[model samples]
Target: MKKIIILTLSFLLICFLFMQFFRPKIVNSPASADFQAPPNVKAIMIRACYDCHSNATSLRWYDQIVPVYWQVAADIKHGRESLNFSDWQKMAPADQKSKLWEIVYQISAGAMPLGSYTEVHQNAKITRDELSTLKAYVNSMAAVALPDDTAKINAADRQYSQWRKEQFLIKQVPIAPNGVRYMPDYKNWQAISTSARFDNGTMRVIFGNNIAAAAVRTHHIQPWPDGTVFAKVAWDEVEDKDGNVKTGAFKQVEFMIKDKEKYAATEGWGYARFKTPKMIPYGKNALFTTECINCHRPQKNEDFVFTQPIKH
Candidate 1:
């Protein structure tokens, strides 16, 4: 019995020693450029997300062990792929704001910093105060875009004229990079929901097709029947001195067309976006849908949708 136990211990030690050689390296290369935010907000992000989301990763001693190290490496790889603070300035200004907005969204949905990570690194867990601060900062970005009442009216009028010109000039229905066609029929669909997103300064209306409407009426929209379609149209939110809000400049329109088999890769829904009044299609390539899917991932339980339809 004593001999057997000794042999087993020896074998286990050897296995452990061999595995150490295979541990993956976590490199902390100097950042090319970093995300620019208020010092407080940046400090919070560094404490909570830098471990995996940024190039400046720091692993605890236990985290460097074989299996744990493997997982940490993988998490860092995917986390950085999603958003790397080191590469922040490389993105366009609009893209930077969008990414920050997405970060706030993921955190709000409890889909960020990853539960698995926070379990081991308690300091990485965001506090309520930190979340509140982040929200305030993001919302403040919209205020930067706001102008005086006279400028607001001028901007709206300019947008309206451009919209008319686009309607007259565009002869062909544009198609998204993902092969989803521009769905003009959504204009005839029922408005199912409306939202005023002050964080992004956009007013949005969600429209549902006959199939989606029927599913909603019957309360069968948990997964929503295949063929159910939704269109989300957005415009710049214009506010007057009295603080009343209305849709101003045309921003974009997006569609979610459902087909379990056809759109199996994208959570059983095809996504398309037409931007500006000219209806320019979004995406440089089909891979652009990856960004869309990532953004909607937190709402997967809601069939990857953010809108809740009103009772008709």
Candidate 2:
């Protein structure tokens, strides 16, 4: 027993001593002068997000010690790489808007400030009110910028229409025997928003029943409540000589259902798409499902839907 005690202490001391060699280098850089916000919003951001996401990190005592320091350093590195609030003005307007959207979605999903970080800095945890303020700010900016951003995105997509059609149409998606049937009632579901994918030659209008619409409008709740279902109807785009654009041929209809246990394989959401008049099932094989999931991965925090609630 005596020998074991001494050995354990000696081993721990050696490990602690060795950890000193791996101390992460702390960097200090000036914050961007143009990154201005409302006083309250800025305060919330500084308190909740600046540590890992900005150059001006306020390192704590444990942040300077050993393994914890390594984790802190790595997180700082990754956060800065993903988004540096300190360098906000340096990014293009579209990029800035995009990052702000990410912030809103992440905070809403409780994925920011990181659980481990909030555990240590209780003040960093955002209250519902603070989240609302932040979201409001983002929405205000988005209201002015999203139309331009969407136009730009659609323009770029138009250049890739042929390629997109070829990619989606070539896949052999299967129709399950127990697949979702077309429900006439879904047409009366509350309209959520409309979007266009010029690159795919398609325009889409999304609808969700009361439960799902309420979840989207709330903006802070996540994993949308079970029983919520979203239907997105898509059609080809056609333009008249007068520059009026209208829905053309029917493309497909896609549905996303939220049922945690039922769709565990697809991250708590079940995806299905039916194409053309016959409504043949799509995503029958692994290739189809993999592609769908990959495309939605970026918006996983927002329940895997790319179409955000239309700001009024």
Candidate 3:
């Protein structure tokens, strides 16, 4: 009996040790500049989809466990196989547009991130309003199909790429009062005040970043007039109570005119909300208030996006 008890304890110890060796590869892809998503869409995708779909996964401590590690790896593999935002440039224009549309459908149909995913990640659950907004955005993208001819699309892409390269070379003026600085790499950060204006049946405002612009453009919204509204976005790193470095990535600020013809008037701007995969599945909306909006209120005059311009 003594020998049997000893063997049992030894087996349990071996199992525990073996489990530690089965650590899963964590997803930690760098954010790519080549592909940009809209502020709102980007926020949602980062919180929910990035874990599996992109290289920017924010791994949690539990992900290091053995069985759980296997599950995470499998999910990430499947997610990336289905769609990878990091590789958006590699896809044809049509494919990119189509995939954006599919994202909306999947989210609306409650098929995204998988129910199993949400069971563990309460934040991944989509609210009705969020779903509606996403649907509208996706539909707008689908409405504007690239020219049917494949060669024409390729030609357009080449032209766009050249234009972007040229834009990158242009000298940038520095603007401040919002913590922007010039880097040797030609990226100019600016701190700009923001406001909103609606005029002639159109909403117009100045914004920073092509991703935000493309997100707005894809939705078929008219651009705000130049200088009508200005904003700046930045991230600050700080340590948590536990002395862990906490990063506030994807911070944003925006300003917009609430009524028509009053571009100078400031509407409320707040931090855009984002959630992690773990929080997304639990159907929690309050997380937005805590994790996102509170910090953004300081720049309420802007429409809740940090409106700093980057040189290409």
Provide TM-scores for the models: 0.76, 0.53, 0.42
Across residues 92-116, which tens digit of lDDT does each residue of candidate 3 receive? 8776776676576556545676676
Per-residue lDDT tens digits for candidate 1, residues 136-198, read 998888655544487776778677666545452456989999899987678678999887775
Clashes of each: 0, 3, 39
lDDT tens per residue, model 2, 1-312: 999999999999999989879876879688864456899998988888889878889988877888888888988987777767788888887767666766776776567778888888899999999999987787676432112234544643553353234433433444533354444355678888886543334578898978887887786436688878888988766554555565666677778777888877887777778777456777646346565675466466677866666546
Q: Judged by lDDT relative to the true structure, which candidate is superior, 1 or 3?
A: 1
Off by over 4 Å in 2: 142-312
Displacement of the residue 312 alpha carbon in candidate 1, Å: 20
The lDDT for every candidate, in the order shown, is 0.84, 0.71, 0.48
True-structure lDDT of candidate 1: 0.84
What's the C-alpha lDDT at position 281 in model 2? 76
Q: Tell me, by lDDT, which candidate is best.
A: 1
Better of 1 and 2 by TM-score: 1
On lDDT, the stronger of 2 and 3 is 2
RMSD for each of the candidates: 4.6, 10.2, 21.7
